[model samples]
Target: MKKIFFAFIVTLGIFEVHAQKEFQGMAVYESKTSTADMKNQMGKNKEITPEMQKLIEERMKGMFEKIFVLHFDRSSSVYKEEEKLDAMGGQGQGGMRMMSSMMGGGGTFYKNVKDKMYSVDKEFMGKEFLIQDSLPQLQWKMESETKQIGGYTCYKATASKPVNMSDFRNFRPKDQSKEAGKEEKKETEKKTNFMDDFELPKEILITAWYAPEIPINQGPENYWGLPGLILEVSDGKTVILCSKVVMNTKEKATIKAPKTGKTVTQKEYDEIVMKKMEELREMGNGPGGFRGMRMGR
Candidate 1:
């Protein structure tokens, strides 16, 4: 029995190698984020009632649940959101647009494992940016646990990623004391602006599941470097799961980098976004401006 099991493993390895030589596939992933934490944070505000909270959750559900497609070959992949019509007839169009910009959505992400590089075509505040950067190096800890996704056997891997300060999903409301001295409150208000009401954690844990049968080291979004093709990923707040996979389709997908924006590196892009947010805060905090407005309110 031991020899048979070893032989089976060897045979699977051989098949995986052969598949990798000519594998080309498209995978559909359904992504959804849990807004429970955000809601709880916002619940601190006395202005929000139970009905208001429910309404907010409903709107956020529509904004956070999304579909994405990953077009991948052996060494490269292109991941992007699958566009869909708004069910509310564009009622919350502006909110959706803002959420997309804040979450880094509606972009073309191209990754080249062979070159250890990635390129993203991102549009923020009506400006296009081509962000080119080296792929992030993650120290993945592989686990002995196994599961099945879309009929493929998968293994578990986990890694820690630094939280991006600019990502609004990572924001948490600041704790303020209502009983502070008037002088202290005035000093705090003078030193800080609306943007200071939120803070981001230092890091987030990323859990992924990869299927060795796929024989490609690719994944949804910026995750990769596993022994196989990643089929699902969870970062505590959001969960991305593979719903369907089409292997070796008749129409091959074009896996090329985008080139139609102001070129910048990842760091530069983040700085640009931060600068823009600061500008908005200044504009909104001026006389008769959009002040005293909390996020997600």
Candidate 2:
């Protein structure tokens, strides 16, 4: 009955909001990065060859260009990728696995303002993890700045958080992990072997522009708690910007939490990933003898 009622409401173009003119609809975001900027960031790296550099840059441009959708009503929203198996220029898989996690890649994100809880589907080392966590409380400072994105007037807000290199890549470098473990620690403190190995930056700042006209506090990937719908988000190196919005359209969709993964809180998921990654590193480090012993752990 509830589903039928929602269908009827969608038919009438009304769901939750009383103001018919107000937006209770969907927004499409195309996340893009400046290829030139990426090429520049890579200029300092010693690992990429000049020939490999050209191929990798083209691959980066092809891969990072993505589409995300925001299906929002008054107080709830679900953001996910619009699936497309893009051509990767027929390039072979590179030395590293996908860096999508750094890109905030494919995850069904469900947010509820009333409940103040969020869930994300994260895949790590062939395991799908359902991460349930309390909504991040961001201390945002709204500015007098304004801009127009996809025909909507937007206001600016800024916040910052600590960041880590592992947060951007699927796996931590085996050498980096070893170095982190060498640091001394107090035995009384909970061991950070699985946790502290990855190095983190002092901070990452987020600058987002939201549309007050829309009035939905939602945005791509874990960014929310704003007064309006977030249209563009920047984290220094990457940016997710809303390219299109369809207000009150007949595209039938529902926002729901994901199921059927190893259910875990965010902290537990991180620990599990580290344990698996360590196993992989150890397995690769071996004559298959010490590797087997470590795997037994």
Candidate 3:
């Protein structure tokens, strides 16, 4: 009886130690560059790239859109809730709404990720890779440059992507009005945009910060794989930061994928998305064009 009690206490202690070991940190990102055209009161016809012309025609083929942001830690990962924002007003809403609609309704909201143990070995592109299932299978190397961010020492890393605009496909809304006149349908067709392919950005740079006091490796928004917690990530002009950090808390932490969207490859989706945006722009005015549609009435 004494031996059994001793063994039980030992096992319990092991479980507690494992449970307390978790990596958590906050990340923040700020917009540094955007490629959208920002002009006012221009002529009706403007010559665009052949690529832009193609995007104008493919805008009429889909019913839903979604934007996904990934998050990661060393051992496990969780996809945070995705929300859609209305892009009609030139607002900063990305593809979150269309994705939410495709999932049925609402969005997935989570407090944090909860993985206790993670494998240290993983492979990517035939190379020995860091074992992070929650992050993309891309390469990252540390740079000599260093700086202080959010009060933590950070190192710079760079990642690059070729131009590939294939992940957007939910922007086009088809005509549903059966009793509408033929002229209206014709007009919609004339305003449509189509694309043959999408392009990827030229490069991405990440400047990550790690907290030496925190022993676990984790950070916000699909970033991991450093000796310490990363508090910031950036790609050229785009930057994300961590506003909060928690080492060990008593609350139960659960990490799971959100069910609020349809699954799609990035390439197949962005192609449709870019085209639909162009089509909407070609509508001359906004969705229910009254601001610019009437001349003398």
Candidates' lDDT values, in order? Answer: 0.76, 0.66, 0.39
Q: Model 1, poorest ten-residue lDDT window?
A: 286-295
Candidate 2 per-residue lDDT, tens place, 1-297, comes to 999998997967654345633446888888765455345434534444576557555545544677889888777788988876646433332211234543566678888776888888866555677888788788999999998898889999999855533354222223545556655553345431322333445577889999999777788877899888899998765688888887786765777788757888876876665565567555553111122112212
Q: RMSD per prediction, one decimal? A: 7.6, 9.4, 13.3
TM-scores of the models, in the given order? 0.78, 0.70, 0.47
Q: Which tens-of-lDDT digit does each residue in 166-203 have in candidate 1? A: 56666654555633445466554443233344567678
- The number of the candidate with the highest TM-score is 1
Q: Model 1: residues >4 Å from true position, as ranges?
A: 1-22, 47-58, 88-95, 172-198, 285-297
Residue 241 error for model 2, in Å? 0.8
List pairs with backbone clashes in candidate 2. none
How far off is residue 3 in model 3, in Å?
7.1
Query: Which should have the higher TM-score, number 1 or number 2?
Result: 1
Candidate 3: Cα lDDT at 120: 22
Worst 10 residues of 3 by lDDT: 34-43
TM-score of 3: 0.47
